[model samples]
Target: MKQSFVYILKCSDGSYYTGVTSNLSARMFKHNSGFYPDCFTFNRRPLELVFYCEFTDINLAIEKEKQIKKWSRAKKEALINDDFDELVNLAKKSFGK
Candidate 1:
């Protein structure tokens, strides 16, 4: 079965970009190479791969990408740092709001 990936890229400007891809290496190359001038990562070049999770199902990968894209920066950072405690706290805080 083909694998899919949900990834987070840290832009040079300190912003995050979330995406889903079947070919991570090729996607990273394209992002760093500025293959598409209109793309979000085009001007935010020199991106660093911060986080990634593999999925056997493309639908699940896309769903995860969408979910991450809606996350706050703090929540995203917690996830990137593998701070599950902080992640839970942030989610709870958001839920209470």
Candidate 2:
């Protein structure tokens, strides 16, 4: 059985990064250790796992990753904080509310 995970990392610079992987722990280790060649987190080492959601299906995980990647920084923060209402507010503001 294979499990996919959608995860977000808060970089040293306070920026958020969204990605999906089958091996979350291994991926985090690689990101922190710079073992994954040419990875986006290669230079952004020491990232903290701010958020993660597990999915049984790869497509669902990938879809969620893409969606999170498209979110605004405020929205991402809201998500990390588990503030659903804040996420709604961010979305409304994004649309010129």
Candidate 3:
């Protein structure tokens, strides 16, 4: 069975970038090497792999990547820090609490 990964990178500018790939090492190398000039990480060189999760299903990995891409920075950080309580709190619908 093939494995897929959803990863997040911390850029030089202190920003985050989310992506999915089947080859984590190769993808990290490409991102750090500026393989794609127009890629988000290209300009934000010197990226650090902050977090990653593997899935046996590529479709599920892709779905997770897309979902994460829509998350706020705080939410992403909560995930990276493995703070499940914070993640759940962030996911709640705010009601001016």
Task: Estimate TM-scores for all models.
Answer: 0.94, 0.88, 0.96
* Prediction-by-prediction clash tally: 0, 0, 0
Ranking by lDDT: 3, 1, 2
Encode model 1's per-residue lDDT on 1-97: one tens digit a residue.
8999999999999999999999999999999999989999999889999999999999989999999999999999999999999999988744353
- Those runs of model 1 whose alpha carbons end farther than 4 Å from true positions after fitting are 94-97
Candidate 2 lDDT, tens digit per residue, 1-97?
6999999998887778899999999988888988986877777777999999989999989988998899998889999999999998777744455
Poorly placed runs, candidate 2 (over 4 Å): 93-97
Q: What is the Cα root-mean-square deviation between model 2 and the actual structure?
A: 2.1
Q: Write the per-residue lDDT of candidate 3 for residues 5-97, one digit (tens) a residue.
A: 999999999999999999999999999999999999999999999999999999999999999999999999999999999999999996785
Q: Please list all clashing residue pairs in model 2, or write none if there are none.
A: none
What range of 10 consecutive residues in model 1 has the weakest lDDT sum?
88-97
**Strongest candidate by TM-score:** 3
> Candidate 3 overall Cα lDDT vs. reference?
0.98
